[model samples]
Target chain A: MLEIINPSMVSLIQSIIIILSGLVILIASIGILTFDKDMPNIVYVRIHVLGMIDVAGIVVFLALGQYMFAVMYLVLAPFLAHAMANAYFYGEDDYNTLYADDMVEDKYAALNAPDKLDDDAVEDESGEDADSAEGNADETASENLDSGDESND
Target chain B: MEILLISEYFLLVALVIFLISSMRVISYKSVAMGLIGTSSLTLAVTIILVVAGTVLGLGFFKDIALALLLLGVVGTIGFAMVLRRQD
Candidate 1:
């Protein structure tokens, strides 16, 4: 069904396209991991990197002669990205964090929304960075064990 | 019998990415990283599946990639919601 382009030619195209996309994905993966600690909102940066992956992947699919999936992803990718961003900033995700807890109790905090939002974003990034650090596992494991024991009781 | 008619160069690269993203998803503590990593891993798998399946003359791989694509979107939304969920 995909006879529009000669098969051998298609392979040559895919070789160039797929390799490039794969390399892009790899480079972006490195960025995501490497900058996870350094960035203030790593998720936003991740989302952008993922957008690059999406474009590269779509090109790979087009080279593979799969037009439908390429289009499907094109339509859905923005929606998915939006969902992620909205969920991060708007979703009630910060309840467990002490900062969210403090902000929740203060009624007048809404007046400072513009200023506080940036601070909260930075704080959340740092908190999550610390949470994900390799050496911090021992602390989290112990915390989890304590929580598990509490649940058992 | 040789499986795929295509070169193994991209396959090896895809496999490396598959492994790296898999590690990120499992080892990372931040839920957002887990979320992003899982989606990245899914795309990497999709690339591997589509390329290998096409070269091997298997149409099912494309179908599987379709399924993975759909799930990747659904899973991204679910992860975000889970992250946003009130504790």
Candidate 2:
């Protein structure tokens, strides 16, 4: 019960765990960003960092012997966030190429090459068709108005 | 206090597993692999606390159990949201 738990010891453990976990999380983030490799490696690094956060959150909760509800909420929220992010980012291809500027440029050139049907060409074609349709509609409306005037006269 | 010490030892072991499993999570591109690692870490911590409570007769197992349940719910909902948002 509350009567038996040592508040100071709990606080000390909480502080230590928080510090250690925070350091691990920090290192893991740095490693992740610097680790410019495949998706598996990236995902592994991300999970490691998340694990630190997870442990840190739990330790903090245990340390906060009284504010169980509040700490528990805080802990769950971040875990949920991390899990969602991980699953979303890693659920697809395990080896997504980290597209760099060179890759982007290459993709742009390939997609925009002459004699090929591309998104830009399709957009332009649609735009021109829309304009022509609008012009025809305007002419028809004008003719209708003129006929109406003639009938009135 | 005795329970706290036992919990600390268990947590120490859990931390070791966490650190190792974290590397696997980062290296493996599989979502399942990452989730497995996460589960291992979760289970280790939860079991440690539960065992500590039971061994010490601390009468705090209910609180720990509730926390684990809450974690499970949050994890499921979070995964669902991820699924809904996926392209």
Candidate 3:
């Protein structure tokens, strides 16, 4: 099997693989740069495709006897994936904030219906009257305590 | 070998692509987009350096490329956190 492999042919094949992978990565980088800022899903998909091309390049490097490059590429692959995923998932908070005003109005409209407000208003008024009566009783109790102190003095 | 020479040229092409894209970083209006651009540029440069290392037989360049890739990921996450905090 080893004798059947032509060294020059292997070299050419490896070179082609490396070049193709590099081109893929380069094109993907350009794609990423030009991607729509608003479409995070597309950006994320492109990044994943770029990562696959990077892995292919690393494999080519390994075939060309570049062990260090292969190892480094292997180690960095997960970090890149993690970073891209984090940016895709957690980065949407800014976008949510951008549309928060619209959401707030919709939420308020849903929560505060006319019938609900009428019922809450009546309940609130009754509760306020009761709270005032309780407050008056507490004040009288305090006044009685003060009078008792004055009497003792 | 002629194949090696071609591989080196391809690496150079990739490097040029990375540099060209990186130049557009300032044109992005949104912080997240800018961060994404910066990280992509960093990743491209790292890939170019790894290709160069294989071509030139420089072991250290591969290690440096790995370190840069890790740093790029960390920096991208930090930028994401900053953007979240701003919101």
Candidate 4:
């Protein structure tokens, strides 16, 4: 036989837990917001780790029905906070963008010799001219349709 | 019945506020302002839970659930501290 627990006792425990979850999420939000972009990659990883914790807190609170709705909010709060930090502070393409461009150049160099690359550029220039001709034909067709409409009117 | 309906209405409002605040927190350039917005959202959610708890009786699920929520809060604070120190 299993021992029975009092329902009131459970409520008290749940309330306490809910309050704790809220405080943690608040701290995480503050941490992520205050984190400077100049910090090392290790810092970003740590922030993400905390974000994962926040997610866990939300899921647990969601399960508790006493303040289930309340728990849901606690869970969502960190996700929102962390997500914002990611988009605003961490999203700047400054260093990464330059690095990405360098990577692209390296790849392009690897794929073709410098002379061959110049040949490809000339080919593209010709291709663009062809495309412009095609575009002109499309514009002419649209103009003809407009003229037909004017004639009907 | 009226209490339940009222709670539901308030819950909806709170949910909308939560969404708006979240968006503002993310988009705002000021880190401090974003934190304030997030705190406001936390408060709103807490109110929501209290209102919902009043409507729905406390039970076993509630206790376990609240404990988990507390853990999340703890985790958030830990991560925040880690991040703050990194900065």
Candidate 5:
């Protein structure tokens, strides 16, 4: 059977496989970047699925090239997938915290109040404890007002 | 020669994806997406190198390609772990 297959023809077939797999990787990258916002778990799974396609393409290309070390890559691919999945799911809480911080910053900026600057500083120092920062800001603002009244009198 | 040309085209496609993925600036999602694009780009490059090696009758390039594939996998997993820990 090996003798029957023309070497040039085999080379051509391998080249085609490589090209096709490269295209798959390209398409999957696009999908991963442009995917619409949806369920977190679903999105996470979809990205990993695309990643698997990429790994499949790499394995195919390496195997067609007759590289024996392809097995090492194949073995490591799953662990990479698992790591990405864990980053997505297990890190949800951190994402939520980041989102909340962004909201507070936006709100604080829009108010355009000078006293909020102190609160912003406090928030930065304490890291994500906005309520306490707000209380401190209120106290400082009142203190400033009282001092202003005394100086004016 | 024909294989080399086709592989070059594959490299071009992968480069385009890498550029697009790099331009993403939103969030950790972008980081993950960039990692995928980078790995794909590495794979495409490896394919080109392998074809070149075959044409030149050199066995060394194939070993380099295999090494690159291993690095791509390891780098991706490391980035994912860092993202997970930082988050």
Candidate 6:
């Protein structure tokens, strides 16, 4: 099967992949075993290490030239990670995580604020927007004046 | 080839790693850490399956690896849900 490509090169890649996958699993195992359980936010740390497991799994698939499995695993690993993450996120009543605490929404608003101001700057710079705003203001003022004239008459 | 020999050695190392991770999974005191260990265990199994398949010339092991991968994700999710409900 590998004769289509350089067999030695393919073997080298597979060897490297297996070695790397072993190292990743070893590290993940250590982290899972030795990480401080007393920390309040330990789940995130655990999840981070577990991500290496997912990466190693993908590489091992690629090493075996199973692109389809690699792609499928890639697509699904995030969902698994997110599940583990959300288990922490929604599980706590006092969940003070940033996502649950509206940090993301606030940051999103903060990020979009400058864009909003930029839109206002565009409105200020564009003659059409400025003219339309002025036109509306003038129409309101003229309507007020006409009402005053009717009252006076 | 030396590369294939080296790959077999690493595959052996990976198998050992898998055993250690499975032991680690059994040893976690905390639920969250246990979940982490579970994920690592599943992933380690997936890696070993591929390694065994490759060295043994069993192409169908890739399909089993794929199934295990999907099962890992599903199993983790299911475990997380159970944990969430308990909390």
Number of the top lDDT candidate = 6
Which candidate number has the best TM-score?
6
* Candidate 5 residue spans exceeding 4 A from truth: A1-3, A37-39, A42-46, A63-66, A93-153, B1-8, B11-19, B22-67, B82-87
Q: Which residue pairs show backbone clashes in model 6?
A: none
Put down candidate 5 lDDT per residue, A49-149, tens digits, no spaces: 55656565555556465645566666766786777666655455456557878899988786887788788776554433432444546446655444545
RMSD of each: 19.5, 15.1, 13.4, 16.5, 15.4, 9.0
lDDT of 1 at B9: 54
Question: Candidate 1 docking category?
Answer: incorrect
Using all chains and alpha carbons, the TM-scores for the candidates as numbered come to 0.64, 0.32, 0.59, 0.38, 0.54, 0.66
Report the Cα lDDT for residue A50, model 3.
58
Task: Identify the superior model by DockQ, candidate 3 or candidate 5.
Answer: 3
For model 5 chain A, give the 10-residue run with minimal summed lDDT.
A125-134
* Model 1 chain B worst lDDT run, 10 consecutive residues: B1-10
lDDT of 5 by residue, B1-87 (tens): 477466646755664664455354123365554555555566556655665676577889888987897887788788878878874
Candidate 2 lDDT over B1-87, as tens digits, reads 554454455454544555564465535565545554455455345544544564466767747755774786467556645753665
- Candidate 1, residues B15-66, lDDT tens digits: the string is 5765585577546666666666677778778778887787677989989999
Better of 2 and 6 by DockQ: 6
Q: After superposition, how far is residue A117 of candidate 4 from its true place, in Å?
A: 12
Higher-DockQ candidate among 5 and 6? 6
Candidate 3 docking classification: acceptable
Question: Which CAPRI category fits model 5?
Answer: acceptable
| lDDT per residue (tens digit) for residues A32-137 in model 1 | 5676455566667777877887887788778668899899988988987877766766553453344666777675677567888887776655545545543456
Estimate every model's Cα lDDT from 0 to 1: 0.70, 0.53, 0.66, 0.49, 0.62, 0.71
Candidate 4 ranges with C-alpha deviation above 4 Å: A37-57, A66-92, A114-153, B1-87
Whole-model lDDT for model 4 versus the true structure?
0.49
Over B1-87, each residue of candidate 4 has an lDDT whose tens digit, in order, gives 443344344444534544454555546564433443554444445444544554565455344445554554455455444444442
Per-model TM-score of chain B = 0.75, 0.51, 0.82, 0.50, 0.64, 0.79
Off by over 4 Å in 2: A1-14, A37-41, A66-91, A94-153, B1-87
lDDT of 3 by residue, B13-72 (tens): 876775676567535664544665676677667767766776687889877887887787
What lDDT tens digits, residue by residue, belong to model 6 across residues A129-152? 434445545435545445545655
